[model samples]
Target chain A: MEKIKIEICVGTTCFVMGASSIQALEFEIPEDLIGKIEVTESRCMEFCKDHKDGHHKGPFVKINGEVMADATYDKVLDKVRAIIKKKEEN
Target chain B: MKEELFIEIGSAYTNKAGQDICGDTIHFKKIEDEMRTITVLSDGLGSGVKANILANMTSHMALKFVESNMDLLRSSEVMMDALPICQIRKISYSTFTIVDSNINGKTKIIEMDNPPFVFIRNQKEQVIKNRTLTSPKWSERSLHISQITTLLDDRIIFFSDGITQAGIGTKKYPLGWRREGCKKFTLSLIKKHPNISAHDLANEIIEEAKRKEPNNISGDDMSCAVVYFRKPRKLLLLSGPPYDMNKDKEYAEMVSLYQGKTAICGGTTANIIERELCLDCEIDKTSFDKKIPCASIMEGVDLVTEGILTLTEVYRLLKHNIELKNDNAATRLTKLLINSDNIDFVIGTQINNAHQDPNLPVELEIRRNIIKKIVRILKENYLKEITIKYI
Candidate 1:
């Protein structure tokens, strides 16, 4: 199976708004999902700028182009696991 | 068109042993509009507070007079007449050396009782002719004036009598480190570190002079200044992401084509460069500071740090003129900023929405305001030329 791409926004706005905590997603990935996913950091994905007045906010994380705004460690983990599970089933 | 040489002026001084203040003063002014620089080193008659006052006054007046383009001889005569005579010594005395140089042009040096200035080219001392001028009213005092067309890699060093008269009665040399001794030492130093900066050279000369005294305690108020003519060191500091996402490529191209040291101060900005330039960005985990974020490494960039927070720390450090003892991102950035002669700041105008919250600490100031403060400090305090552009 092709690896899932996870890009975390570490921009100034995202980092201060809890992107730093979300950065831990790199290490907290479950052992079964480690090799199946690739994690990277993006300086700024500009999601905060795009969704200024929307329900979405930052720290933002993207899983295969799906942005998770106002992201947290557990939220990212759950999303990553769900994606991996779906990938396996498909 | 001829390229203007960057005149790096550096001075260092040590007070007389057990004295709270140095009796020697070095003053420098850069006339940006005229593309000229004037540096003056003054040594008063004696050590302690009285000497400090005399030296300060002489240097201040000398700089002002030279800036006004007054006649050097007449200026000296006026200075001599205005100085107050010491009650105990029955003489008002201060020695001064004034260096007026036009960038990419001729340099004029006027020396009084202070030691003759050392002129070096290609690490070798060059002989220059001097014209002596005297005022009949003060017949005993004479001034030596010299003019030379400065070239790249040339250096002019001047100092107070303290440097020459160190260790007057020492067992090693009763004569002390005279003019020849100082010259020889400077030449040897230049030979070792051919591209030594003016700041380090001045500091090393002062340290060596102090070592000549007993127990490394200077016998008099020692001072040394070096004027080095050389190419300017440039640095490009990129911070924040551009407001228009389409301009990210242009921002990265600026970093790719910059002809000097480069630093990235924002995570988002670094990401854009990394993506656009196809460069790898890796976090250096060990460099993390409690307050500032850890720095990253990117190919061809001198420094990569998280924005806003790191910049704020840099501002504090530069403002306080603090000595850096930590290997954190902020200190590293500050070191690079200070070492460069010319700095170009590319500030991304994109606002970070998180910073807009009022509850956030006031120290997390808007990025533009912080950068403006840093630019002012760099210019006024460190004498660095700064150019800023908002993308």
Candidate 2:
């Protein structure tokens, strides 16, 4: 199976907002998804500013290049689960 | 949460004339004791020396008043009273942009009759809450001031009228590069070079304004400044050799464990790092950058320089009274220091017999004293994060 890449922002803002806990996410991964997922820590995604089209989101996690703003442990987990299920079905 | 360590400032300016005079004045002061940083950019009523003095005084007064914790509106009112106004124009002699940022990341920006400052976040425009303050005096001027807690990667970009007036009469755009154009251009630049230092970003904006004109001459003095916030950048500097010969691996191990950039000073120290880390230290003597000894390269180390000469030069540069830019090992080290939010000095206490030899042409201050002085200048003078460790 192809690996699923997740980039978590640990820059000052995100870290303060609790992205620091994202690093510990890897240790808690379920057995089924252990090797199938790859988690990386980025110092800063540098996206604290609002976009020209919309507002900026914080505590972001990028899964396969898609940004999930205001990330949470359960929210991100559900996102990964859904994506994995879709990939399996295909 | 602990306060963010320090803020980095970058400024660039182009005068209305190719000559020595510029009507715009920009000044920045960091007060470590008070835990506040004040920056002011003032544009005088008109161009030339007369305007220069007015703008200079305005910036100076603004910093003094704001740093003392005066209410900004009250302080600005007093400031307008102090400066002479142009009676015909019915405006104060200077229009200003003032930024007051505290250690806690709370920032207040006050602007009077200039282009609206651009504050960006997450690759989009931040909608700042601006309140209006009208001058009570006969002067009919109005100001916009906003207060917001800044986040990492948040940028405050302000510029003089030269940018607002660029390409006004040119066939390209009779309206010139207005605030909207400026914002769009900045957003594009920020998108392309997200990690650019404030200095480079400011210069890019000023240059873009110059390009808008076919004849390439700005109608007024143009200046731009950027304030960027980020997580503290940590640098570990290893110099000299450990007092205990046995701790050579320990020093190398510390560098190996450091997450930030690493700088190795002295040939012997470089050899120590090379030996412990099992990496090759190669000296590139090809460059004719004659100002100092040629720098070296080693795996896992960001910068490598000869001991005394380079350290002495870096100390002098850190103690440098004037603000200027240069390309050398010392300057490179300074750039790294300026860019970093904090620096850790890992000192080796060994005293070299050769450096003590009177026959040598160089003057060497005790390495500890040099490091201490560098730390003082960084903390007290530049208000940067710095600490020292002796081995």
Using lDDT, give the best candidate's number: 1
Each model's C-alpha lDDT?
A: 0.87, 0.77
Best by the DockQ measure = 1
- Per-residue alpha-carbon lDDT of candidate 1 for residues B1-391, written as tens digits (9 for 90 to 100): 7764698888999999899999999989888999889999999988899999999999999999999999888998899888999999998899999999999679999999999999999888998999999998899999999999999989999999899988889998699998888999999999999988898899999999988888898889999999999889999999988989999999999999999999999877888899999999998766754456678899899999988988989999999988899999999999999888889999999887667766543447788999999999988777788899999
Clash count of each predicted structure = 1, 9
What is the TM-score (0 to 1) of chain A in model 1? Answer: 0.84
Q: Which ten residues in a row have the lowest lDDT in candidate 2 chain B?
A: B284-293
Using Cα atoms, each model's DockQ against the true complex is 0.29, 0.01
Q: What is the TM-score of chain B alone in each candidate?
A: 0.94, 0.87
Worst 10 residues of 1 chain B by lDDT: B354-363
**Per-residue lDDT of candidate 2, residues B266-367 (tens digit):** 667887888899988675433213445446778888988766666777778778744546566666777777667678988998876534535433456778
Candidate 2: docking tier: incorrect
Query: Clashing pairs in model 1?
Result: A43-B268
Evaluate model 2: give its TM-score. 0.72
